[model samples]
Target: MARFLGRRLLVAIPVLFGVVVLVFLILRLIPGDPAQIVLMGTNASPERVAQVRHQMGLDQSWFSQFVIYVGGLLRGDLGYSYISHGTVAAQIGSRLPSTIDLAAAALAVALIVGVPTGIIGGFWPGSIGDKLATGFSVLGLAVPYFWLAQLLILLFAVDLRWLPALGVGGPTALILPALSLGLGFAAIITRILRSALIDVYQQPYIIVARSKGLSNWHVLTRHALRNATSSVTTIIGLQIGNLLAGAVATEVIFGRPGIGNYLVSQIQLKDIPSIQGIVLFIALCYIVINILVDVSHGMLDPRVRKAWAS
Candidate 1:
């Protein structure tokens, strides 16, 4: 297991490097000079423009600038934001907590809502419970997140005055954003969990459990659930990436302050450093989540550990 983890970590470094390179080059490809954008808002002289460009390292050759950025990254400095005029690491650090909080809450809701629906539906396939669960899952999958957020705002915020339209206040503030994010993930989880449950139920041990006069709940919670956890864990691990991406859209729609909101504003202002920082932070989050997923596979299933050991 330790060897497998070491190999995974070894592989992740190059993947992260590739993601950084791709994201950096793609941002550069987009036609807009960050210095020019900054100058457009001010009555700056040519010297001033040159100064801003020099400070941002835009006056340097692209290769030179790339080297500087790579060097700074290696030293754990994300660089200064060209627009905000602040350290990229500090700016991201401030907003990251909120995004993480929101994403974690949404994923928790997805798991809580999705797993039960799937288990019940799969345990009694084609029953009324199954149909209801499937229908709800369809609704979740079909609804667009932004549209749902807006509708929620209208119904709960405007019409009924039950919750704030935007900006988190309390537990109530979480409901709308969580719902907006969770519904889609819940649908995905439901499909994955249902399939896994179906497969687990077909195993001979399940039949033995049934024949041994075990209650349905006991069999499910113990025998079937143990075997099914790895699949559900895999789905959850994969969805961490989606959750992070969705946070940007959700934060914008809900008027919440998070890394996504900060990113959108920075992109509009053509803050190259901020853009690079945000993408890098997101990439790091993805890599870390994947690592967690790998560890979870071994933790949730001894068979996986045994296979790795072999």
Candidate 2:
């Protein structure tokens, strides 16, 4: 396991490097100057603009900027926002917890709803329950996050008066946004798990377990579910990235103060450092989640473990 983890980290280094390069280059390429945007109402002279650019290190060559950025990263610095004159790391740190709370709640919702529905559908393929699950998955996939968020707000907050429609406060405020962001992913989890369970149920080991006079519930819970862990884990890990992406729209619609909301605001303000920092942070998260999934896969599946061992 140590060897496998070491290898995964080694592989992730290059991927993270590439992400940093892409984020830096892409943000630079976007139209509009950060300095100009920052000094929008000041009517600053060209010399003033030049001074701002120089201070912000925008006057430096791209390569030099990249090197400085990389160097700062080595020192755990994500640079300062051009607009706010605050460290990107500090800004992100303040906002990241809200995003994490939203994402974690959404994941919890997805797992609680998706896993059981999927198992049931797998247990009774072609039955009415299975059909219903499949139909729900399709609907979930088709519904846009913003539209769903509004609908949830309308139903629970407006009409039913059961929850608040906007802003973050307590657990109740989290419910609607989490549902809107998570249900779509729940659909994906349902489809993947249902298919994987179906395949696993038909495997020889499952048949052997059944032939040993095991109950259907026992066969499913003990044999089939264990075998299906790898596939389920993979989907869950992949969906984490989707959850983060969806959070952006969901946070905007719901007025949640997550990283997603912070990111959108920064984009509008053309805060290049903040945008780049946020993108890099998200990319790092993705890479780390993938590594965890790989490790979990190896742990859950004997075949994967064997391959890794070799």
Candidate 3:
């Protein structure tokens, strides 16, 4: 287990390094001058722009800047943002909790809604439950997030007056965003889990268990659920990566003050330091979630645990 974890960590190092380099270079390549943005007008004198560029280390060669950036990263210095006038670490810290909370709530809603629907759909294939599940899953996939968010607002917030339209602090603020994010994942989870459950229900062991006088529900819960969970766990793990990637769009539409909104602001302002920091932080989040999922799988399945032991 230790060796496997070590290997994952080792691989993550190069992966994160490459992400940093790529984002840094790409942001630099974008046709905009940070110094000029600071100058606030195109007619700013060249000498004044050069001084701002030098101060921000934009005057350095790409290689030199890259090396310095890497060194700063190794020392836990994520550099200052040219636009925000604040350290990247501070900026990320301020907004991290909102995004984390939003993602967690959304994922929770997905699992709560998806898991049972999938189990019922798989266990009772061709029945009314299966048809309903299929319909909901199809709608989930077909509906766009922004559209859903807007429709939810119009229905619940505007006409019905049950929830707030914008901003997030209370339960009302979270519901729309969470549902918007969860619906997509719920559809995906339902599909994967239904397939896994179907396969598990057909296994010889499940048939034997049923023949041995166990009720269908008992057999499904005790045997099929455990077997199906392994696949569900993998999907849930991958979904964490998706959340980090998709948070931006969801947050923007919802007007939630999260890392996604911060990222959007940074990108618009071309704040390279903040952009790089956020990207690196996101990569770390993905790696950590994947590792946790692997560890969880090891704990849940003895075969996996034994494989790690060997």
Candidate 4:
């Protein structure tokens, strides 16, 4: 277990480093000067722009800037956000909880809705229920989240007047955004889980369990679910990554407080430090989520744990 964790951590180092470099380089390509944005107006003369650039270390060559940024990262510094006039980490921390809460609620909804639908689809692959589920999952995947978010707002908040149109209203406010965000994730989960369960059902052990006179539900719950969930666990982590990636649009649409909303605001404001910081944080979130999924995989399957042990 220790060795497996160490290996995962070791692997994450390079992935994270690559992400930092990629985001650093990509953000610079966003058109317009970070220095100009920082200096605040087009009226600043070239000399003044140069002075501000020098002060912000934007005057350094791209490679030098990358090195400096990485050096700060190694020391646990995410740099300062000129927009917020504070440390980037601090800014993200203040809004992190809301984003996490939103993502968590969305994930729970996905699991609740997706898992059963998947099982039913796998249990009767050619039945009408399966066909309907298949169509629903496909539609879920096809629809854009921003558009769905609007539809949700229109239906629940505007027309029905059951939910708030914007801002956080405790759990009720959480519902629409979560539903919008999670429907797509649930669609994807249902398909993947259905596939996994179908494959599990065809395995030798499944036949053996039936031969032992186990009830179908007992076999599914005790035997199939545990085996199939290893794959489902991976999807859960990927869903989190997707959820956070989609968060900017969702938060903006709903007027919610989260890293996504903060990030979009900073980008439109052309706050380079904040952009880099937030992108890095999002990348780190992906890495952490995937690592946790891998750990869950081992827990779900003793073979995986043994493989790691050896």
Candidate 5:
């Protein structure tokens, strides 16, 4: 397990390096000068702009900038925001918790709702439960996050007055946003887990367990579900990215002060440093989450464990 983890970490290093390089180059390619934007647009005197650019190290060549950016990264610095004139790391740190809270809540909602619905559908593939689950999956996939968020706000916040429509505060504020962000992913989980479980139920081992006089419930709970979880785990892991993406729209719609909204605001201001930092942070999250998923996948399946060990 330790060796497997080390290998996964090693693989992530290059992936993260590529992300860093790509973000740096891509941000530089964006039109309009960050210095000009910082000086309140092109109205600023060229001398003033030059001074700002020099102060920002924008006067340096791209390769030099990249080297400096990377060196700062090595020291855990994300640079300063051109517009806000604050350290990018501090800004992200403040907003990241809210984003993480939203994402975690959404994931919880997804698992709580999706897993059981899938189990029910899988346990009786041809039954009404399966049909209902399928219908739900279709509806979930069909509904867009913005539309759902608005609908939820209208029903729960506007009409019923049971929840807050926008912004984060306590648990009540989280409910609508989490539901809007999570439900679609829940649909995905339901489909994947249902299909996996159905396949597992038809496997020879399942048949053998049943033939040994084991009850349906016993075979399902003790054997079939465990076997099916490997696939479900993979889907769940992959869905983390989707959940974060959804949070972007959801946070905007609901006025939640998460990194997603922060990114949007920075983009509008053409804050290149903040944008680069946020993008790198998000990419790092993806890499780290995937590593965790890979490790968990190995632990869940002996075949995978053996492969990794070898």
Candidate 6:
């Protein structure tokens, strides 16, 4: 396991380096100068604009700026925001918790709902309950998150008066946004787990367990669930990435103070450092999640473990 983890980390280095280059270039490729955008409403002179550019290190060549950024990143300094005049690290640090909390909550909802529905569907592949679960999954996937969010808000917040429309008030405040963000993930997980579990149920060991007088629930839960988790784990890691990306829209719609909202606001203000820092941080998270997934796959599947051992 140690060697496998070490190898994964080693392989991730180049990917992360590529991400650093790609994110920096992509942000610069977008039209509009950060300095100009930052000074948009100001009556600043050319010198003032020049000063802002200089302070932002924008006057430097792209390669030079890249070098500076890479150096700063190595030193754990994500640079200062051109617009906010605050350290980029500080800005992201403030917003990171909100995004993490929201993502975690959404993932929790997905697991809570997805796993059981999947188990039942696998247990009874063509029954009314299975059909209903499949139908719900289809609905969850087909609907746009923003549209779904508004519908949920309308139903629960406006009409029913069951929950607040926005803000981080408490657990109630979490329902609307979490549902909007998590439903699709829940659907995906359910479908995948249903299929995987069905395959596992048809295996020889499952038959043996049943022949040995094991009840349906025990056979499914103890033996089948353990084997089915590999696929589910993969889906979970992927959904985490989706959740991060989707949270941007969900945060805005629900008026939450998260990394996604912070990124959106900074982009409009052309806070390049903040944008770059946050994006890089997100990319890092994605890479780390995938790595963890790879590690988990190895742990759960002996074939993968043996391959890694080789």
Candidate 2 segments exceeding 4 Å error: 31-34
TM-score order of candidates, top first: 5, 2, 6, 1, 4, 3
Q: Between which residue pairs do clashes occur in model 6?
A: none
| CA error at residue 162 for candidate 3, angstroms | 0.7
Task: Pick out the ten consecutive residues of candidate 6 with the lowest summed lDDT.
Answer: 26-35
lDDT of each: 0.85, 0.88, 0.84, 0.87, 0.88, 0.87
Models 1 onward score TM values of 0.94, 0.95, 0.92, 0.92, 0.96, 0.94
lDDT of 3 by residue, 26-120 (tens): 65776678677655634679898898788767888988888887888888777787567788888888989889888998898899999989887
* Model 1 lowest lDDT segment of ten: 26-35
TM-score pick, better of 4 and 5: 5
User: Please, what are the lDDT tens digits per residue for candidate 5 over residues 1-310?
Assistant: 8888888888889889989989888657767877787666547889988998887678899889888889999998887886787899999999888999999999998899899999989999989999999999999999998899999999999899999998878999999999999998889889988999999988999889989999988998889888788888998888898887887888899998989999999888877788888888888888888888888888888899998779
**TM-score (C-alpha, index-matched) for candidate 5:** 0.96
Query: How many collisions between residues are there in candidate 6?
Result: 0
Q: List candidate 1 segments past 4 Å from native.
A: none
Question: The CA-based lDDT of model 3 is what?
Answer: 0.84
Question: C-alpha displacement of 286 in model 3, angstroms?
Answer: 1.4
- Select the stronger candidate by TM-score from 3 and 6: 6
Off by over 4 Å in 5: 41-43
Q: What RMSD value applies to candidate 1?
A: 1.8
lDDT of 2: 0.88
Candidate 3: TM-score?
A: 0.92
* lDDT of model 2 at position 217: 88
Cα miss at 256, model 6 (Å)?
A: 0.3
